[model samples]
Target: MAAMKSTLSDAARQVAANALQNTLVDLLGLSLIGKQIHWNVVGSRFRSVHLQLDELVTEVREAADQVAERAATLGVPPDGCPATIASAIALPVPQADWVRDDEAIEIVTEALHIAATRLRKRIEATENSDPVTQDLLISVTAELEKQHWMFASGHAAHAQ
Candidate 1:
């Protein structure tokens, strides 16, 4: 008879590491994009738009922290260094041309949508391996989806 191989599910660890790396990369892009817009925001809506953009940067930074900590908890080195993240992240190159609320929303929504999709895949990978990790991904993904939905809804309404 063939001997059965022993196995332990560490899929969660893999998911955590992947997510942490991706999050930091996206966060770096998010920070630059948000700050660029914040500094150059113009028009009569400056105050309101500035405040909202600041909140978004704050939220993305928080998510980065959570993902990094989770990676450490899983005994993996957190994958981030400013230069490396900048180079590795697959975000749109920071553009300083968009000066409208809808423009800002479009850029941010696209980036966050990418991040959210990545997280959803991570959630699936970890779901059967670890409920804790799956729950974490789901929670984070939900927040990203909320932002995406807001952006998408605005576009839809405007188009109609």
Candidate 2:
């Protein structure tokens, strides 16, 4: 068997940086989605959902910062203004107005689930080339997925 390569190159690092920039874009996307869900949630679970919204956004915002910093570490500036995020994100169409509590939660759950899945793949890619980065993406993905399931099931229960 051939011996493993010594390490990634500067060009490889730049490629990693580009991927990191993409991750940062998703981070901004996810954070904004969380904030939107929190802002628009309604229904019988008002207090619970609304209260949890703040926590969701708080965590997502932190994750966004972490991803941005990771991009910085890789020498790529994270380009994530609201417009950029809106342009880049490929999530479902969100309602401009507040949705029924269940709809709001469901939309958010799906979006988070998608983000988590995407992040997991990005994490794996960065794992070999950049361990420090892989760690943050892994942690963020796990948390988002857990939250996704929680909200998804809750939304479903409300419908039943």
Candidate 3:
């Protein structure tokens, strides 16, 4: 089959492809982490954290889809395979089979913050190379930041 063509110049295409691929991996990893926490979280705050994890997983999955599609649109093959994500994901790993609700909050909050920070770098990398991809990264970063704030804030509320 003929390779798909992209409107972007070689350098620009490379930049956007790299950014999108990395972002996709992180998003997919975040979704997995959220689901893990949702299933294993315990304590009196379990119900609330579980529900929030579901919402976070939904948002992360949606963002991953968007990032992967954007890569395809740019004529880059998006690799979201488990192996790729496992190798590329920079997010924290769960230490145990079960986590306290507050601990889950801390873990997810830190993960989101880390993902958002990496996204900001991707946003900058794509700024001059491909503003369209940069825009998508910016939006994804915003949502991640929002989720991070929510998790952090909720944890604080519980502490008070």
Best by TM-score: 3
Q: lDDT (0-100) at residue 7 of candidate 3?
A: 88
1-160: candidate 3 lDDT, tens digit per residue: 2167888999999999999999999999999999988999999988999999999999999999999999999888899999998888899968759999988999999999999999999999999999999999999999999999999999998899
Off by over 4 Å in 2: 1-8
Model 2 over residues 115-154: C-alpha lDDT tens digits? 7878878887877777777787788888788888778877
TM agreement with the true structure for every prediction = 0.78, 0.85, 0.97
Residue 17 deviation, candidate 2, in Å? 1.8
lDDT of each: 0.69, 0.74, 0.93
Question: What are the C-alpha RMSDs, in order, of all predicted structures?
Answer: 6.0, 5.6, 1.2
- Residue 3 in model 3: shift from native, Å? 4.0
Candidate 1 Cα outliers beyond 4 Å, as residue runs: 1-12, 154-160
